[model samples]
Target: MTGLLVHSARLITANSPGDIRDDPTGWVRIRDGIVTATGTMEGWAPDGDEVVDASQIGGPGAIITSGLVDIHNHGGATFAFDGSIEEILQAVDAHAAHGVTRIVLSLVSAPPRALEAQLTRIAAARGEQPGILGAHLEGPYIDSDRCGAHDPAALHPPEAHELARLLATGVVQQVTLAPELTGGIEAVRQIVAAGSVAAIGHTGADAGTTLRAIDAGASLLTHTFNAMPPVHHRVPGPIGAAAADDRMILEIIADGSHVDRTIVRMLFAAAPGRVALVSDAMAAAAASDGEYLLGAQKVTVRDGLATLHGTSVLAGSTLTLDRALRNVVSWGIPLGAAIASATVVPARAIQRDDLGRLEVGCRGDLVIWDSALVPRAVWRDGVRIVADAVAHNRPLAAG
Candidate 1:
């Protein structure tokens, strides 16, 4: 197998807090789709079949980090997750072009039979691309009043039989629910028992009930402060409970529309490493803004803001992870924290250790960005998938 070496770039390892090792001259070696070694340029010896001098491509401030991971996304490229396999693949490609290499296909609230079909199709889609992590069911068992883009007519109280059926597919990595519903706490327990993450989302659950759900094994808060109640000093809600708990990982949209810039900074301060930046993006992401469908709801997207056809409620977002990364950084977040929130943080939120870090034995998936933080090249499994003209011409092969 051909070994590849990438040298002369800032590396955000994301293995731990304050772990950014390489500032402007570092190297990483990949063999057979796995990172075999990484270090400063001084320790590097040129012994690879393929070599890339990142500095030549992205100038003096080139940055290389593990490929961004999106844990929650409906679809992109004018395709919804409930669409056919071809549409799903197209959506995945659109996000990948924007530096999201690993993604959990999110589905909105729908009937049991429909959801089962979607899950099964997503499982098949995962087979087509190694980047498709799995499926994330974001509804059906959530609060109707809090169902942002999910169909209110499809909302249902959590039931053991239905939950068991969905988890039985073994392809579901996470399930978001309103823990305040009947049997909701037990549902959290059941999801955990089935090796699936139970996420508290789309709910009117008070802080007390939200904490109870967390204790019952709910470890993720989906799209924090969006579908749930706000934090009131007298009546704290799920966002407040999640912020106080170290075990909970809060998912933030970071699109500047779904979440305010100040609140985005505050969540990072409150939860620190617990904040997972996700693009709760719908079909309009990476495409022109117009009318779109989110599950059964009619959505109209105007100037990149998506809302219900006739109302002001946000349906989803026309956001990509790369933009989310830049948004947080522009909002005064530390560079390391912003990168981790887009990469390792979301990977850990879904319990994926093989992704989100450029460590030895991790997948050789990374993004090379110019000084402006825009991705100039993307690599997945040791193969460059997307690259600009400069990146294509800058590979300095060393024998």
Candidate 2:
């Protein structure tokens, strides 16, 4: 049986909720693409056919954590996920460079036929690529007032035919729509019944409507506070309603642009263990500043911020999980907690417990980094995707 071992590394992982064991000097063994054993420096043994000496790679402060799982992302190649299989693979390689081992490909607003076509393509790729976690439709049923980068014309009430077709594909794992739409709450109920996550976002719904959706089994809030009404002292909006609901999983983009660092920390405190940091990245991610297409919408990327062309409306983002972890740590959050937000938190949000964390039964996906939070190597399904850092000399530099 082929095996690999990582020894003398700082393992930043949690055995369970509230049981984070950020071991300083730890070792983990992987056999047949699953973690088989783990321990600290006490009585380490070289069992892997291959070994990674974290100390030699980056010396002390070398940290290892379960690979990040991005639950919301449009695309990352120069092109978007709304492309061919090869383009999707390009995006996968792009984000993998930034330590994202698992991803739920996001699709922007489009006609039902268009979205369904894209979804079918992504569904096929999901089977081909273990890293792809299926599709997340972020539009076609969103509130026009807060559509963000989505096309207002494409936004409409969730129809049963469209909903039924999507569920039949068995490709959609999540749907983001305004609960105030006609039949929205009923759609939420049906979405949950069909084994898909119902999320509220791009919404102008009031607190009451938001809570009703939660009662109807809507469990996630998309990019909290981005396209939704904020917490008003008089009328608490979706953000307020979700903040008070323990059953809601809040998706926060920690890129420091979509959300401020201070507010992100406040949300982390407000939601406790229920917050999942998502990139919401578009095609410009892992690339230089340029223009890109996001679901027939033109977007400009400059200085890492993606916004609509000829307008100030912020588009998705150019964020990657690695940069998100660095941003939070720089804000004074503990490294272990920050790491969990990018890793385990998002995994659990998507109900993929088999992907995150370093345990005997979990997938052998992880990132090796330094004290500065720079990813040196990334492994997906026990295969080293990022063999080495070409920019190792520029370690710890903020993007």
Candidate 3:
């Protein structure tokens, strides 16, 4: 485990530092927990304490890339992130097997006290759990009319005192709130000032309001096209504004049911590397179909698509990042572009440069995939998390 050589891969290289692309037959070397070197076998040899033959597992279709970074996730394995610390890491482990090596745990809107508890606990555990990047406060500051799957009663406008308490916890990485509400732009300003990425979501904003929020430092759009108003010829909502602004990063579900493949392609064409493929995944991500709760509202999962129990309002998703990569590729995007969406794009969105790359001095977190892009192995911080990727791909026990 001291040093390992992983070569003969579809070596994914960053096209120009941040624009990631793929080249056939890639190789990487890991010394300790840092990426020591990476390149193809033009004039080199494969030698290490333990040599991993990528071709031995999947013939000529072996693809290796930086592990997917999920900047938005609720929970998986039927365990909600709002639970205790033990449950949170368990849920993260479930997604880890599917190539989601890092995560920003997202919490749905809740009461002020409950949110404070969640934030404090997560902040305290941030350093202890390397997989957890931070907590995303998908808030009580949303537009009630568009509160998809969130309890309307729990949804409220932003307050200075509440924002102060949450920010003081020091674990807030991003906050998703409706920008059309009263003081919405000001809230965006506050969030950005406190060093957290402000995001616009569940809003009834027109293009003008969306632009103002962007001007006010709102740099991200959460789960585009689901809770917000749809694009129109006259009243283009946040989606149009995001498309217009190159600085804004948009998050897409890419579960095929939440957004159509045609729209996904259009989004890629519209934004290029600005799209951060996020799994706004819920409790049933890697588990069997059953009853789950996305925040206080009950959710039902039948055939891996989660929604409000009696209604058609889609509640998060049961998708993993690897599946998202596959879904995007199915939409005809190049493999490099798709990988960028899942890796560097999301890392840049969160401003974590240390992740989502295979360069020297970067953390040795990478995923080895088979011919179809399904993960066959996963490593985090130079440590193997999944002993056998094929075994984890099987149907997991329902939590």
Candidate 4:
């Protein structure tokens, strides 16, 4: 890669309140695929390499935010996770065009043999793609009652040997399981011990059981309200427990179907900076209304709503993080808070300190949006990956 110089842009750091420093005429320098320096136009000048004038692309009101980090997603475009390696690459490229720079490929519940084979393939393909972060196993050990679209036959208690083997692959970055299931609490400890984040999801655990799981080291609540039991005056399920815990990070799918707008607002108010907006999208994302396969089950997409072919249960979302950000802001969330949920909070959830901020020494992953908050250009690791060059290199396929 080569050096890059970005000039004349409004930078939104999403770091602190004072971090949104305006620069009618400022410049940011990148060298060796990292942000080196940023300052006003008078203090910095481009010496070599490529120079990008942000104003020329999106004009004065252009908004610049950190490249989004989606830690959980099953598929996008027409590619499903269960497909071949070529299909995975196609999915990664599809999401990259939408300003997602880092993504954890979330896999639904599957048999041990199938899951291991998929993990091995993903491990082999790491670093070959720009934004393929790692794998997120969201299954095989969860409550059968809350399985949602996952195949219930594959649900079982987490085994120590099986989990050790999955972690040993070095490709699994996050795992979601129900704590109330057999051996579930022990599984949380084992997953945490392997340096991977253990998330609580697809669960039927009550408040006490949820608290115990948190005490055991599960730090994430996957898709907060969709798979878990609903909050009631007497029950106060996992959602309530997560709300009361300060150390937990809650994931919300803001597709407007999986969660109510009012409920999303309440979660934002309750969690403050701890909520991370995730897509939880499957193969239907960025694709048209049609039939699609999620793991072993079939789903039908209608008006962007995906559901199991014949059931009322929602399968997953067809949302992208950029659209989710827009939805939150549309629901009266502050732009800064909404941006933080999509960027900083998710980055923090995965314990990635270097990303989700535009400070010096951080990776130069950024997106420039027009006044309407539509992406105009996206950059990953100081490299301009989206523009006329990108369009020519890889034209987007029609959804």
Q: Per-residue lDDT of 321-376 in model 4, one digit per residue for the tens? A: 88888778988888878887877788888888777777688778888876666678
lDDT of 3 by residue, 1-399 (tens): 567677787888563334565668877787787888888755346554467877776467888888889998999988888988888888988888888888999999999899989887787667678989999988789999988888899988888778988988888999999988888888899999999999999888889999999999988999988888999878778899898898899999888888888899999998888888988999988888889899889999887888899998888888888888888897898888888888888888888877888888888888888888888888888777886675233221121
lDDT of each: 0.87, 0.84, 0.84, 0.83
Expressed as tens digits, the lDDT of each residue in 1-399 for candidate 2 is 768888788888976545688888988788888988888885567753588887777567898888888999988758688899889988987888888889999999998888888888898888788899888989788999889999888989999877999878898989999999999999999999998899999999999999999999999999998998878889989999999998888999887778778888899888877788898989987777888888988898777778899898899988877888788888877787788888888888777887779988999997888777888888887778887743222121223
Q: For candidate 1, write residues 311-369 as lDDT tens digits.
A: 99888888888888888898999998999888888888888888999999999998888
Which runs of model 4 end up more than 4 angstroms from their true locations?
16-27, 40-43, 388-399
Model 1, residue 75: what's the lDDT? 96
RMSD of model 3, in Å? 2.9
| lDDT of model 2 at position 223 | 97
**Between candidates 2 and 3, the TM-score winner:** 2
Better of 1 and 3 by lDDT: 1
Q: Lowest-lDDT window of 10 residues in candidate 1?
A: 390-399
TM-score winner between candidates 2 and 4: 2
Best candidate, lDDT-wise?
A: 1
Off by over 4 Å in 1: 17-22, 389-399
Model 3 clash pairs? 9-26
Q: After superposition, how far is residue 180 of candidate 1 from its true place, in Å?
A: 0.6
Model 2's alpha-carbon lDDT is 0.84
TM-score, candidate 2, is 0.95
